[model samples]
Target: MEAAFRYREREGDLKAPYEHTEGPYPLGRWLSEQRRTFRAGQMDGERAAELEGLGIVWDTADAAFETNLAAARAYYRLHGTLAAPRGAAILDVQVGQWLTNVRRPGGLGQDPVRAERRAAALAAVDPDWNPAVLGWTVDWQRHYAYLAQLLDEGARLRAVTAGVTRHGEDIGRWLVTQRRDWARLNPEQQARLTALGVTPARVVRARQAPAKKRSTTTSGRGAAAFEAGVQALAQYLAREGGGTPGRSHVERLPDGSEHRTGVWLANQRQRRDRLDTGQLEALAGLGVPWAAS
Candidate 1:
């Protein structure tokens, strides 16, 4: 069940609609079967024990579902939709005041709805009553609240998992940036980058590298080439260094005089085999420094 939850969270969109093969099971049929099984208890000791365990598990699952359903219905009754825009507005107002009380700058500084109202008044003789406009504002607030909730949950989970102080805003921003970058890249590129454990920031920084300004001097070209070579070496080291012994490994240079050089050479070789010059240069410039040789 845990594995199923993870798979749904990670790859739900990728799954085919009809991949299950079997049609949906009827809750009524399942319940009837359960009732029969419970009535036939103690017929076989192993079967009886299994049925008893299943009953407990089923009951727990049903109770959780019921609790969640009741919460959803209550929320909808109070705030119109599950999105809970009015609730979100109240939350935003509370957050703003809370920040003011703490003497810290809060997001947007004032009520977002008031800002929208002021904009509408300036643009027209009266406030806009378009259902679409009103709906959009509500939707935006709901989205904000939904995201805040997700961030809060994620922070709690991460605090437990990583045993670190919860930094919800930083983590939320990182997640948003990562998702934006992932959305920008092709699936193949995303997969390759993910496989290599490369992050979106690294990719974005590589893309934003200053254009290689042409150098007029021969020495400048040499410096550039040397820099390029150094970068290549670093990549080689990263690819080949630090692993269990007897696997692909870097041998230390004698007297450690050119240890950096040796490491760079190793890394350069690996980078050459693994990537094109353009890719290598980009990787190198993104702070993948070559070992001192």
Candidate 2:
């Protein structure tokens, strides 16, 4: 036991796999701890390389914005209300403020809708990359509230029309006709109805706003585009007046906001292999490689 304690002093017990909760989150915790050590000037060159090889940063950062939204959504479900960012709670104020600041206009801020869609697209591309999901869950209470009001109106109308032989077919037909109305709805109204499970089906699905500039990563072309983007950037950077890409970049979010990140970050190799989808496309647009040899 004494020897074990001494050995633990020299090397921590974190090398083993964690029990119970096992996924990217635990791994992300380890990665973050190692990063803290590196930041505090504790990691040597080889150790740093090993940590880099784990590819934790690339995955975490790529998923970070959306994952935070997912966790927040999960919080709302368990807690029975939207916390700080979305809700008007005092307890969740600091937390909510932090969330707002984190996903502010400059860089990757919290956007659950876009995150979910991108995650869905990623899952469509490769199911293995599926992260913790918080989906478009329904609020039956709101649906009931709306339905109750409508039903009351129906009752009043029926009482007035009792002299005539009338059926509720008109109401039923109107309700189902909402399917046609769904497509005509603006995005927010459709979203509200969707949340209430009252949205109707339509032949035409709303189209996503196109990216102002073409992004190869979002495009369906697979490895070929990635390799070509890498080659393109390499060629562009090698030409003249090109700098290794700033970690900060201009990104267009789903809300039609063009956000430019304020902070510059390290160029982790794993990022190229993982998070490089959007970044590479941005670089390709600017006609330069992110990192040139």
Candidate No. with top TM-score: 2
The residue ranges of model 1 lying beyond 4 angstroms of the native Cα positions read 1-170, 176-262, 265-277, 280-293
lDDT by residue for model 2 over 45-96, one digit each (tens)? 8977755554324233444433444444444444333213222233223434
Q: Against the true structure, what is each candidate's TM-score? A: 0.18, 0.29
TM-score of model number 2:
0.29
Residue-level lDDT tens digits of model 1 in 1-293: 23223334555521211112113533333433444565556246675555444332233333322233334434444433333322222322332222122111121126566435333422242122111222222232333333444444553322322222222223344344444446444455456445534345443334566755542322556446545544334333332221222324333332332224445445554645444444444444333444111
lDDT score for candidate 2 against the true structure? 0.39
Clashing pairs in 2: 103-109, 233-288, 233-289
- How many pairs in model 1 have backbone atoms within 3 A of each other, for residues 3 or more apart or on separate chains, i.e. clashes? 7
Candidate that would win on lDDT = 2
| Residue 261 error, candidate 1, Å | 11
